[model samples]
Target: MEIQYLGHSAFKIKINNTLLITDPFLSDDPDLGIKFPKIEARIVTVSHNHHDHNGVAAVSGNPFIIRTPGEYEVSGINIFGYATFHDEKEGKERGRNTIYLIEGEKMNVCHLGDLGHVLENELVEMLGEVDVLLIPVGGTYTLDAVKATEVVRQIEPKIVIPMHYFHPKFKFKLNPVENFVKEMGVGVPEKTDKLKLSKDKLPQETKLVIMEAS
Candidate 1:
């Protein structure tokens, strides 16, 4: 399987013969100055209606789209979306966020889009075992560095990928990824433009792998 980060909560994933994308961010996030590549995905998912996470139009091809919590199967891949909040106020402030768990090729990849709070015991139990975790570590709109560290501990994924945090190209007010790294007591993680992972390569313990936006 191959994973590429498209900046600001967006990722393009390739598993087996299937291609999918998560949280297609708008090309022009005046703040982020992000110009995503022209992508054509067989399946697209929007974590919520937010402009930064719901750029379904940016994706080419009439892709199968998922936007709510449910069980779905498409292109030989299985997906499960769970209801989550974008703010601690329970949507009173920032509306709902959806955390997606994708299963395929003997791996489970979980993408937490703008998750605002820690998971309850039930949600944590439902997550089960995650091979790769995409989490938000930037504060303000999502979990801050400290909270994200907490979430990592709760889920205990084999590979952890931090997203939605500060980057040179990002034009938002948020804490830098370095803050999260510090909180984790791990030094700066190795940066890769893409990750080609398999069940055999999964680390025995949690590993932080940062992907440079390509």
Candidate 2:
């Protein structure tokens, strides 16, 4: 499988013939100055109603959209969306967010969309094993570097990819990825445009991968 970062929390994941996209924030906006390259996907997963994470209309192709917490099977991929919150106040402040576990190509990829708090033991058990964890490290509306590192320890994924952090083009106020990198105390792998991963290539110890926004 291959994963391509599309800025912010958006990612394009390819497993065999099927392609999946998370948080389709493709349209150019004043807050985020980058315009995402056009790409078609078979599946699109939206975590919440926020414009940055729920721009499903911007994605091309008649994609299968997953917006709520549930179990779904699209093509050959298995997806489980666990109900989470966008704030620590149990959605009282930011509403509900879905944490998606996508199972395909003998690998499980977990995308924590705008997660605002650390996972409880029950939710951790429900998540099972996560090979790749895509988590938000930007503060303001989501988990900051400190909280993001805590979440990383909770899930214990083989590969960690931080998202939703402040970028040079991002106008929003948020923590930079460096804060998370320092907190994690892990070496930063050279940033790549796309990450080519396989089940065999997974590291035994958690490895941090930085992907350049495509």
Candidate 3:
């Protein structure tokens, strides 16, 4: 499968003939201008109802969108959506969000959209082992660096991709990507514009892959 970073928490994953996009924030990010290419997909998975995560209208073609929390199977992909609170204090204000686990072609991909806090034991158990983890590391709207690192430890994914941080286009007051990278002291990170991975190419140890927005 190939993964392309589309700024903020958006990611396009291509597996075989299936193209899945997560939390597509395709517009002028409020803080940053157009940082990534404006592209459409065959399927769009939204984690929550937030503006950044639910910008499905920006994408053309009117792809099949899975927004609510549930399990679904489409085009050989097994998708599991779990309901969770979007705040650290556990639903104190923001209410619930959906955490998605997509299984396809021997690979398990997890996207924690605007995940604001740590995962509970049940959630972790339900997630199982993930091959790739697309997570939010920016503080204001999601888990900060420290909390993100802890989430990684619990999930034990083979690959971790950080997102939702500050960029030149985003006009928010969130911290930069460096904050998350610096906190991952022992994580071996590779900077790239895109990434392609298969079941055989899965890393043995957890790796932090930083992709340029676009």
Please list the C-alpha lDDT of all candidates, in the order they appear.
0.92, 0.91, 0.85
RMSD of 3: 1.6
Q: Estimate each model's TM-score.
A: 0.97, 0.97, 0.94
- Score candidate 2 by lDDT: 0.91
Model 1, backbone clash pairs (residues 3+ apart or across chains), number: 1
Where model 3 places Cα greater than 4 Å from the true spot, the runs are 28-32
> What does candidate 2's lDDT look like per residue over 13-84, in tens digits?
999978999998756667888886688889999999888888887788989999999999999899999999
Model 2: ten consecutive residues of lowest lDDT:
25-34
What TM-score, to 2 decimals, does candidate 3 have? Answer: 0.94
Estimate the Cα RMSD of every predicted model relative to the unseen true structure: 1.0, 1.0, 1.6
Please tell me which model should have the higher TM-score, number 1 or number 3.
1
lDDT of 1 by residue, 1-214 (tens): 9999998899999999788999997777677687988988899988999878888888998999999999999988999999999999898999999999999999999999999999998999999999999999989999999999999999999999999998777666888988999999877687899999989988998989989989
What lDDT tens digits, residue by residue, belong to model 3 across residues 1-214? 8888877788889888778899876465564566446676788999988777788877776788999888998888889998887897777878778989999889999999888989988889989989999988988878999999999999999999998888765667788778888898865579998898889989899899999866
